[model samples]
Target: MTAPRVDYDRIRDVGPDRAASEWLLRCGARVRYCGQQKWTQDYNNLPTGPLDRYKIQAIDATDSCIMSLGLAHMEGLEHVEKITLSKCHYIEDSCLKRLSQLEKLQKSLLEMEIIACGNVTDTGILALQHFRNLRYLFLSDLPGIKDKENLAHLLKVALPSLELKLNLK
Candidate 1:
């Protein structure tokens, strides 16, 4: 059970078993949800403050459901530096549209990992182009993306320093 308003630092001090979503609000934390629960809806309730860096290693993100709280919640984060979403089976390319609104993350994002997404194809991978500040990217096991030529076309311009690792299997 996650509390709507949590005390992150207090939870951190107590360790992850005692962590809460509120901590993500406190100090720009990094979170990876790989267990049985899905944190997708929680993105909607995040406070209107700049986030630190967050990583969601939802590999095997087995929640076979659509969890969208609307893209309105991403408006407040001005300080988010990185976000990683790997192996989340449910998140598709359309979900990347939500990230376009995060204008502040234009030139400083670190990594974006999208692996084995059932709904994400070339069109979906191309959606990642908006993150102009992205440096490191991992796109393994996606069904549609082909070689670097196609990958280069997806991220045509913007994050010139971008590096991508992909897979077609």
Candidate 2:
């Protein structure tokens, strides 16, 4: 009996690497996710500095894809000047904490905007101080965070020039 044939071309057709890499590359300034993809197949924490090389400008994460933030954070994406997070309530607090590594960037003048994430509080925002180059910030629609003084302290400590635009309204 003959064994079933294997098509190397068909195997190549899946193009998992090409797909993930191209998607991330084409997405400039920001990457938005409204639905989930089977991303874990290619997601790697391995140091491929190319991800950090881009000036990602911004990220608008909403709906089901918010969970992927952990992958983005691990890629050391804070080199981007701005980030907008909305409706990513599924993201864990650890995701924000991951930004602490942004300080390691050679020239880290960046800021982020967070909205509609009910789980992230002022504490999470304050934790961003580790990104010393952060100069502008925005926070809105976070129900768990109770105070700004701590957030103020973080700015005062890490980036005295930091200007935060908070919209609780």
lDDT top scorer? 2
Worst 10 residues of 2 by lDDT: 33-42
Error of model 2, residue 15, in angstroms:
15
27-129 in candidate 2: lDDT tens per residue? 3223422232222222342124433232333344544344434243324333345556777766556667765554443144376777788787766776677
1-169 in candidate 1: lDDT tens per residue? Answer: 9524434455445432223333332223333432324443354554333233333332222333322232233333344454555555547767766665467554435677766666777776676777777777777777756555766655756457788665555
Off by over 4 Å in 1: 1-66, 146-148, 156-158
Candidate 1 lDDT (Cα, 0 to 1): 0.51
Q: Model 2 segments beyond 4 Å from truth? A: 1-55, 72-79, 102-109
lDDT for 159 (candidate 2): 79
For residue 126, give model 2's deviation from the true position in Å: 1.6
